[model samples]
Structure formats: C-alpha cells, structure tokens
Target: MSTPLKTLFDLTGRTALVTGGSRGLGLTMAEALGEFGAKVILTARKQDELDAAVAHLAGLGIEAIAIAADMGKPDEPARVVEAIQAAGQSVDILVNNAGTSWGSKTEEMPLDGWNKLLAVNLTGPFLLAQAVGRAFMLPNCWGRIINIASVEGLLGHHPRMIGTIAYNASKGGLINFTRALAAEWGAQGICVNAIAPGYFPSKLTGYVLDKHGEELRGDTPRGQLGCDDDLKGATLLLASNAGAHITGQTVVVDGGASII
Candidate 1:
C-alpha cells in the first residue's frame, strides 16, 4: 500500500538544527520544520534574538531550543552540536542557513571581507555537517542536510546590483558541495540538498531589496520577490520523508527570477 501523504510529511521525534535561526529565512524554515512536529534547535550569534525566536516558536506551540554561536568561528559548530547532544537530542536535520555577504566592485573588494564571508557561507556549513554527521546522523544512519544557497549562485549578479562576488562564489560552492556530499553519503541514508532563494526582505537582503525592489519585481516573471511563506514548502519537503528519494539537488525558490 502507498504511504499516506500526511505520513510522508510528518517530522515528529526529529530534532532540527537551524543556524541563523534567530531571524529571516532561517527562522522561517525552522518554523516550517517545527510546525510539522520536529523539535528545533536554533543557533545564532546573539542570545537575545535566539531567546525571542524560541519564545515565538513556543507561542506557536512548537518545541524549540536556542544556542548562540558565530558560524564564522572555527570551533562554534562543534560547540553547537555538543550542546544539543548534552541536552539528549541528536540533530536529525540540519539547515546550514547562517551566512554573510560583502558588496564591493571585484577589484575593490577587501581580502579580509572575502575571507570572512567565505568562512561563514561555505566553510561553516561544511564543519557543521561534519560534526553533526559524525556525532548523530552517521551513528543513527539517517539525516537531512539542507544548505541555503542563492539564485546568484546559479547566475551572476545583475550589473546594476551591488557587487557581491564572494557571496556568489561561496553559494556556488555550496550548491556543488550539496551534490558531492549527497553522492558520497546517500548510501548512509543522509539526504543533502539546497534551496536558492530569490529576493527576500530579510535582515541580510533588506538593504538590497530596499534599493532595487522595483527593478527586481519587474524582472521576475511572478512580478514579486519572495515572501515569508515562499521558502516553507521546500524547507518542509527536504527536511521530511516527503523528499526522502530526493538528494543532490538545488531547489530554486526565486519566483522564476533565474529562468531568464
């Protein structure tokens, strides 16, 4: 008999770790997973924001825990994982959503800025995945790894847009990292995938959107940028049995922004 649709989407008994879960896309994805019955562990650099996020999740009746850690720090990922483990929870799902960006004309970009952005956007995800898989997923032989990428990864930034070559390069690397890791670990029952979002007014991209909202909207076939709910469906699928057979893929949630 075929499994019921609801059964495929259920995430009960699962624990999800969402880096940068203090706000924006990360929090949105956390909400999706939690709404489906997963216990969520939200990690970010600021404790106050995390506490507020936890409270918000609690108000929605979703079980959540918050940990503050900077992904740019080399040792932070392991700390976050160990903290969760100490609480008797294993991360069944990991959303590598913590990232940073720097905007400068390519030649004018500072080396330090590029390095910092890459550390968080690319290296941080890899470290967190390694720690989580080694500690929890590999032992249990089941896990979901979702990397938050960007449409800019698949396509170069528009000439009119502020230059963010480091951000673009890091996200591109993440997309390929998802594919390679999925191929390597699929046999172990770990699913690796990515979601490349379009313009969304969040802490990270609010300034860009504010500066070019009309142009971006006009460019998209949907005539709008992404919204709070835009990333939820894709987040839930990749984090649940609903997408068990899916791996090594980048799902673009850009309202058709990259099609052109």
Candidate 2:
C-alpha cells in the first residue's frame, strides 16, 4: 500500500539534533520538527539558553532535550554525538545551524575573525555530519542532514552591504559541502541538503538589519525581509520523509533576494 502524503511527513519515532538551537532560526526549525513528532535535542553554548529553548518547546507541548555544547569549539561536536548515544538515542535528522559571522573589509579583517567564521560555519557542520553519519546514520542507513547556508553563499556582497568575505566564503563552501556529502551518502540512504536563507530577524542578523534593513528590502524582489515562519516549511520538507527523493540540492529561501 502507498503511504499517504500525510504519513510521508510524519516524523514519529525519529530523533533530531539541532545545533545552536537555543534560540533564533535553530529554535524555529526545532519547533517544526517537534511539532511533527520527532524527539528533539537542542544544543548551544549556553546552558541557560538551552534550558529556555527547552522550556519554550515544552510550552508548545513539544518535549525536548537540551545540551550545552559550543559548535565552534574543536571537541564539542563529537561530544554532542557521544552524549546523545549515551542517552540511547540516535540522530535521524542533523541540523547544523550553529554559526557565527564577522563583518570587515577584506584587507582589514583579522585572521582570527576569518578563522572563527570558518570553524563554526563550515568546519562545525562537517564534523557534526561526519560524527553522526559514522556513529549512527551510516550504520542505520537512513538520515537527513540539513546544513543552514545563507544567501551570502550564493551572491557577492552588495557594495552598500557590509563586507563579509569570510562569511561568504564559508557559506559558499557549505553549499558544495552539501553536494559532495550527498553524492557520497545517497547510496546509503542518507539525504544531505542545504537551506540558504536570506536575511531574517534573528540575533545573528539584528545588527546587520539595523544598519541596512531598508537596503536589503529594496534589493529583494519581494521587497520585504523574511519572516519568522519563512523557514518552517523548508526545514520540515528537508527534514522529513516528504523530501526522501531530494538530495544534493540547495533550497534558497531568500524571498527572491538572490534572484535580483
């Protein structure tokens, strides 16, 4: 019998690990997964933030577990996988949303800033995906890996926009990372994909938006910034079985910003 369309999207009995899920985009994605019945594990650098995120999910009747692990740190990504294993749960969906950004002129940007951005934005996702795939997904032969790239990955920074060479570089690399990983893992029933979002109101973009909100809106073909709910459907589509046949693709959710 064919599975119903509704059944294809059901995530019951699965587990999702969302890095930097304590707030903002990460939290929003986590909520979508949990709402569809996946047990969620939220990880970030701050315990308090994780706790609050868990509380917020609970308020929505979505039970979630929290882990305070910084994705930027060298050892934290593997440790997150280990901790979840110790809890007797395997990650079926891995959302690499924990990241940092630095804005500066190319010549003036310090090496440290560039390194930090790559470490979190590119390296962290690679490590988490590797760990989860090796520890669980590869062995189980089924999983979803969502790397949260950005429109910055797809286009050059506008002259009026802030300088963010390293941010753009890392995100651009991530889009290819998604393609490469998917090609390698697709035969194993692992679907690797990316979501390249445009500017949305979040802690990560608060300052950028404050400085160039109107300019950004003007550039977007939609003539508006992304809303809080903009990412929910994209996240769900890629995270659930509804996206079973989709792999090695980048879903640009920039409200037509990248088009113009």
True lDDT of residue 53, candidate 2: 94
lDDT agreement with native, every candidate: 0.95, 0.93
TM-score of 2: 0.98
| Least well predicted 10-residue stretch by lDDT in candidate 1 | 201-210
Q: Output the lDDT of residue 13, model 2.
A: 93
lDDT of 2 by residue, 64-158 (tens): 99989888888888898899989988899999999889989999999999999999999999999999999999999999999999989988998
Cα RMSDs, all models: 0.7, 0.9
**Relative to the unseen true structure, what is the C-alpha lDDT of residue 213 in candidate 2, on a scale of 0 to 100?**
95
Please write out the lDDT profile of model 1 over residues 172-240, one tens digit for every residue: 999999999999999999999999998998878878988999999999999998999999999999999
Best by TM-score: 1
TM-score of each: 0.99, 0.98
Which residue pairs show backbone clashes in model 2? none
Candidate 2: regions farther than 4 A off: none
